[model samples]
Target: MTTTALHHRIDGPDGAPVLVLGPSLGTDLHLFDAQVDALADRYRIVRFDLPGHGQSPSPAGPYTMRGLADDVVALLDRLGMDRVHYAGVSIGGAIGQQVALDHPERVLSLAAMASAARFADPESWPKRAATVREKGPDAMVASRPGTWYVPSFSDTDEARRLLSMLRATTAEGYAGCCEAISGFDVRDRLAEVRVPVLAVAGAEDPATPPQMVRIIADSAAVGRFEVIEDAAHLLNVEQSEQVNGLLAEHLADAVAGSRHG
Candidate 1:
């Protein structure tokens, strides 16, 4: 319920290290709900709605990946956070990559989940963006489940929650993110990421897929990869425990290394 230019919320131990969690395009900061209780004990968790999603107001029209990444830096500056550990899913992960590339000093570590250096086919995004722009969010709902989750997860409470998140999202916001993702090709620059980058994949995710994530891991100078089974695009929610454990370890190690070295 707190308001900012970005609409953020912070919780967990007061003096703990900062951990900023970003959301995929369809959902807001709530995408990390399942991971919060598990990691909050050790981190000051900052979660926020991206522009035009949930509580955050959208900018006029289209948004670039770099633009969104800069918005995050602004949020950190607004809160007096010099640097922080960053984690995100899908579009969120893409933003993390941009930050690491463009604003290296601001990231302690990165957890890039269910994301890739580039979308499988870059051309597909503008088409999708155009559809949402013309028809609206409902135009995307019909085919989302196929890429978002395994067939079995489509009926669960979490699935319903995600569906609602998608519906509640503004078409312009979603389309803007699509434009961002469409042009996002950071593969050539991955070696420039100085911080540790942990790339995570859902084994069954048809969206970004495992191969895409592995490429991210291989591309980064200090990247590592993990694949969680029985999950799809929304791996953090479907396999929350496994993803949380991976993230907790990555963040801890990153923090320890940053301080010690």
Candidate 2:
């Protein structure tokens, strides 16, 4: 909701079609590190940390999903980018949907991973925010392993690294995002999205189930759904190869469709 500059990294070939990657709450741009490393050769990858997370400065108040979307559009404007393909996971995905709705002219396509049009059960978000606000990021980090990843992948080195990223985020930033998720609902507007959209879900993700993502795909004018096998919430990190492949294919398809249209 604040107009402060967000911490962003722009990489890949200059002048290549831009791909903007947003991060989930409790995480930062590192959420897309594997994707950026793999896709940078062919695309211009621009990723940013949420306000109050990573290197970005904290906002004065809590943020709305649409407000975060506006920050991205403003960032794109500052970078002289008029349009870019967008992708995000969890809260990041919610922001993507908002961008497609709030600033359709700025987005060429969308890839929403492990995200839903709305959180079907938002009852726990208040308590989550309160805990992080009182006890700090540790409270959220300690409670995320189960909801964030499946039990099997939760013990891996990469998983631990991601957990570390979560731990490093600011309590105020994480709490603000939890507040955003608590009241988020955009299902009625899903059909309003006109771009080619790809919705991805982790089969084992209890936080936002595949069915929730499917609603996004089913409601969009142009959309598709892909469920990463044996993965949980952070499917992009857990099944990087498969998730990256799906993104590559979707981006390619979107590009081709754009040219044809």
Candidate 3:
């Protein structure tokens, strides 16, 4: 395993097929614990805490999505991973999209989970941005529990644990992610992405919602969408079995696509 100043932690069997994972905003790499266990034997899974979250120290105000994309590239360079299969949820997805568009050769297959192609709604985001900046990631938690987990899942220990992670995020880091969200505009760049893409949407996802996820999946020329039943925003956590199965299938296709094209 390797650690960096950016606080990125990468593990799983070395020299196995690489899959770089980006977690949801407000939460850290723990969100991917279940996924790592499922695929670690066969894949070198790389997961990291974005700047200012988890072990990563907070950065000064206002970082753009492009800036976070640069951070991913830097992490890959540090790890000597020339190219990798990319998977991201929420803010991580947005960063992956930019990376694929801006640095195509570094990406093998791209999977975006509960993420948008662009900030579809502009008027509603500023207040959210302000909240994170002033009150920190914890402030966003009260309103997020139901939106992030399925109805039944919300009451479980796993849900509370995940919520704790989200609530623990620093204001600077969370706001930085929100800054990336606000500035993210990759609609025109989707056509430029030559990589195979998979969009995973939770059927009950309220944050990005199913319709919004569909629009993102449809926007890509070579993309498909998979819906996980009885899941919310955090589909990977709420519906582990279904999400893992879809990941296995989509990642295989992504690898095949890379070989052919």
- The models' CA-based lDDT, in order, is 0.89, 0.88, 0.82
lDDT of 3: 0.82
Worst window of 10 by summed lDDT in candidate 1: 1-10
Show how many residue pairs clash in every candidate, following the order shown. Answer: 0, 0, 0
Please report the TM-score between candidate 3 and the true structure.
0.94
Q: What is the lDDT of residue 100 in candidate 1?
A: 90
Candidate 2 global TM-score = 0.97
Question: What local lDDT score does residue 70 receive in model 1, on the 0 to 100 scale?
Answer: 87
Worst-scoring 10-residue span by lDDT in model 2: 138-147
List ranges where model 1 is wrong by over 4 Å.
1-4
| Candidate 1 TM-score, C-alpha based | 0.96
Decide which is better by lDDT, 1 or 2: 1
lDDT of 1 by residue, 1-261 (tens): 122288899989988899999999889888899889899888999998987789988765567888889889889999999889999999999999999999999999999999988887889888988998899888888787768988899889998899899888888888888888887889999999989999999999999889989988898888899999999999999999999899988998999999997
TM-score of each predicted structure versus truth: 0.96, 0.97, 0.94
Off by over 4 Å in 2: none
Inter-residue clash pairs, candidate 2: none
lDDT (Cα, tens digit) per residue for candidate 3, span 153-237: 8789988888888878888777767776887888876888777788999898888887877766787778889888888999998
